[model samples]
Target chain A: MREARDAMTKYGRKAHAITALVREAEVHRDVYVDPEIFELEMEHLFPNSWVYVGHASQLSKPGDFITANIGRQPVLASRHTDGSIHVFYNRCPHKGVKIASEPCGNTGKFFRCPYHAWSFKTDGSLLAIPLKKGYEGTGFGDTQANGGLSKVKNVVIYRDFIFARLNDNGVSFEDYFGESLSTIDNMADRSPEGKLAVMATPIRYMHTCNWKMLVENQTDTCHPMVAHESSAGTAVKVWKREQGDSTETPMAVQLYGPFMSPYEFYEQSGIRIWPNGHGHTGVANSIHSNYSDVTGYLDQMVAAYGETRAHEILGEVRHNTVYFPNIMVKGAVQILRNFIPIAVDKTLVESWVYRLVGAPDKLYERALMYNRFINAPTSIVGHDDMEMYERAQEGLKSNGNQWVNLRRLYESNEEQDVTAVINGTSERQMRNQFHAWAKFMTMDMDKHAEAAE
Target chain B: MITEKTITDLIYREADLLDTMQWQAWLDLFHPEARYWMPLEWQQQDPVLQPSLMYEDLLLLKVRVERLTGERTFSQKPKSRCHHLLQAPQIVACDTAAGVFKARTSYIYTETRGDMLERYSGWASHDFVEVGDALKIKLKRVDLVNFDAPFGNIQLFM
Candidate 1:
């Protein structure tokens, strides 16, 4: 306990001095591996900032509710009868029993706690308790204005995505997202109906690492070649056996084959770092090229949004886009994953892929193919990632290293907006994340004092 | 008339094949057009709108098997071993047109990894089609007892 307190104090002191001039590169190793910093991050970083709850499609209609965690805080996101969305603390207001036990379901009309039968409307308004007569004598049986399920402050929904802020202060979802919102926009804009539906049951996984590691790994372009080497190498041999040559197989299959080619070609493909710490790395053009199954759907997109706009939307083939903090969007496969920190060492990831509404069934099938082959529990890619994450977590706990280096592209170049366009393999993304992290953790608490002065 | 002993023996042999990691022989047990599925548990009211864990056809199943046995498959480096125990096998129906025998069997399956052991109880509905002299699997639908519960990596063919 004493050691923990000392570490906390040390972090608290250093965090206070963090500024834009703190060399946007080179984060203290403690940030990634330390338990003390992880605890502080849960309190200061996750709770205070806008964290993704789930996609709006997950709860499309009235009584539709899905249980999701926002950094260890279990939340129930429901769509009310009036078509408004509510994110509420899952715990019952009375005796603190969890309101819903299932991962997701339609409550029909209201949420009823199994423990005491205390019910709340879909909007989380207090409806009635079975033993209300006993509570009438006290000040307990109040209406929505007084007693109800605790609502998450400031909920924002944009383009079928839901984000919530526990603290009302800080920034609006627009300001918080900045240019990162384009990833969401581009995804939705591709659909002819201007919407996408959650295509399949989400594949959930638990990784024994800080949630940040998984989030960072999404944009860490360098690891794919090394980490997925075995999978890719095998893919090449299989393709050779089946198709007899690489040219005969489809690009999707070819991309998965031959690990060496991707790493070598990645430099030519280049990466683009956006204004708000969101980075896009990998082959941009191949995302929508020669997807035979989606050709008709692409035509519809061209018709709905116009050919020029459609081209622009389809042209942005960013493999991974880090929406800073909790959300990581994979544009190529239309997979969105959110990392919810379970503990200092464990992270719960909910992976959801979408089907472009009004698109052909074959297109949806293609998406499912990618989901099953690349992201599913049985996936070779997912297994490799999980192994690395678990290993990294175990390695970081050792006394062998005090700091993890982020000095790869530290001195090459700098961006005015605190985002640098470093080599895709550089640790710039991790450094950029910590830069944003320190800002949120040590936010000016003395604003009122300064105002009073 | 298929006796209980014959059905039980067949099921036990199938489990043995899987447990012993005889993947190719297991694959051969299925008919060319076999449909294997593990559907997601949807709300009792609306089934079509929601997605399932698996709604695979033969092609997809072939791809899955190919990938699993593929040399580069990293997830299967240390293969998974499962012990399937069938408690009750009830004959559901016999279709002459399809030349298929249908049966539903309740099972308890346990998988061990090092010291970690996880158990799952489920009922499987098997459809077997007799082609010439051999019996081939037409379909194997497994409905887990706790279908909605969060599961660990389901790496193996369940």
Candidate 2:
């Protein structure tokens, strides 16, 4: 803890200088490249802020658990026998050994540590420890206060999505999410049964770039044209040959193949930025209408939730919704990507696409197609983005320039609370993200100290 | 009765084709209407109701092969090298109507990129449809030992 504090203080000094000239909307190039800033981010930002752990659907039944990382800290998200969810340190209380080794499984009744046979309830209560008489008069006892699994300060489970905050006092999940909550709401509202389940194992990848790169790319409407040119070009040619010029390929394929074309077309689509750094960019209506697969899902949604409400939900064709910081909700494909920063230069990305309950097989297939063809590790499109991100990271590390520009549409647009509409090709999303990042990073360290006191 | 030697020989031939990257020849080993399925490991009550990691038809598989073999497939720039070791081959069932002999085999597929080695152990169940004198796979299902582990690019057919 002391080492973490010292590291935070050292990096905090650097941040002070960096933040002064960079502004809230502008980030220093070193933030993406510097190891010191990355360590500090792990200590300060990651631990204190609300980090998404996993989806509630992942641990749906009692005794079901998924082992995941909250920033750098290993957290076990378990569904208790009482039907409540608990997010705690994966380490056992007795010996600090990780209880659950597998990514996910059912523990049955209780979690028994393999090392010492120390058992704990799924909710992280100490159930039993081997050789109980050894600790009869000792400091350690089978009590919650004595030593249960060190629980996260707060765990918020909303609509099967689980978020945990290490810090006790802060904004409520709703307040913290603010405008971003609508992304989740929109995702759920699209489902015919008004519920969604993670139908498959998350497609995970490691990128040799800053985690911020992945988050920024999630909604960067401009880069698809230049960065993803090769893949998109191939997609277009294939679609042309397979479906011919007259027929339209599925939206998933089109999204992957003609991704570059969208960048060219997005300028006319009009990008809308919301306050709290959440926004969407793209023509909402025509994009959906273009895809025959989505029409059936949209019809089902309309039937379930009426025409007006369903139209409002389905009409919001957001290519990406920045749930601020790490989570990105791609509503069109019913996929969500959570960015986990490993180092300043290393990031682990988990891609999960949900199955809208009661939706047609075709609708699910559309999302599955996107998952397999576009975002999967072997994806032509993903490889392009991965290569670009790696190059960007390498370039930033060089002494070529101190500043990375987000000055694309700087003077063209005014910031609005609900929607800050910018040019489709603008870097406003990047600017908005950095602004939110700065706010979270520099937010009162003294307040944290007071809370500790 | 399908002899153990015959099944082993068939598996060895298939592995050799894959290891040599004879993709077209490998494709010929599958029946025209064969199904290659790698179902998603679900916690659900029924797998039929759930989505899969790969539920592919011949059209998709053809496209996948085309992309992998394409000149501009960036991920395939430095091609993946693989070694398949098949063990414990067993004839599970025989279908008289389809003239298909179903067999289960455990394999350890070791892939190498540069110096990095990744070994994946999985059990593969193949439904072999006897066509004339040749045996073609009517269905091939691979269930990886670590089916749920976070994986990197699986560009090649497993």
| Top TM-score model | 1
Q: Each prediction's DockQ?
A: 0.27, 0.27
Residue pairs clashing in model 2 are: A56-A160, A273-A420
User: Model 1 over residues B63-109: C-alpha lDDT tens digits?
Assistant: 55566665655555665668888876787766556565878889888
Docking quality tier of candidate 2? acceptable
Candidate 1 lDDT over A1-453, as tens digits, reads 844553447454244433422355555556667676777777677776788887788888899998877777888999999999999989998788988877778999998989888899998888887866876667654544346899997999888788888876876777777777777787777678878888456766666677878877876667777777656555655556665443556644644553345654555555666544566665444323445445487788888989898888878776677886788886656778777787778877767778877867665555555655556555666777877877677787777755566676566555434544445566666666766776777673444442343
lDDT of 2 by residue, A254-344 (tens): 5555475665577767666766566666644324335554447767888898989987887776677777668888776788888888888
Ten-residue region with minimum lDDT total, candidate 1 chain A: A13-22
lDDT of 2 at A217: 84
Clashing residue pairs in candidate 1 are none
The DockQ of predicted model 2 stands at 0.27
RMSD of each: 4.6, 4.7
Number of the top lDDT candidate: 2
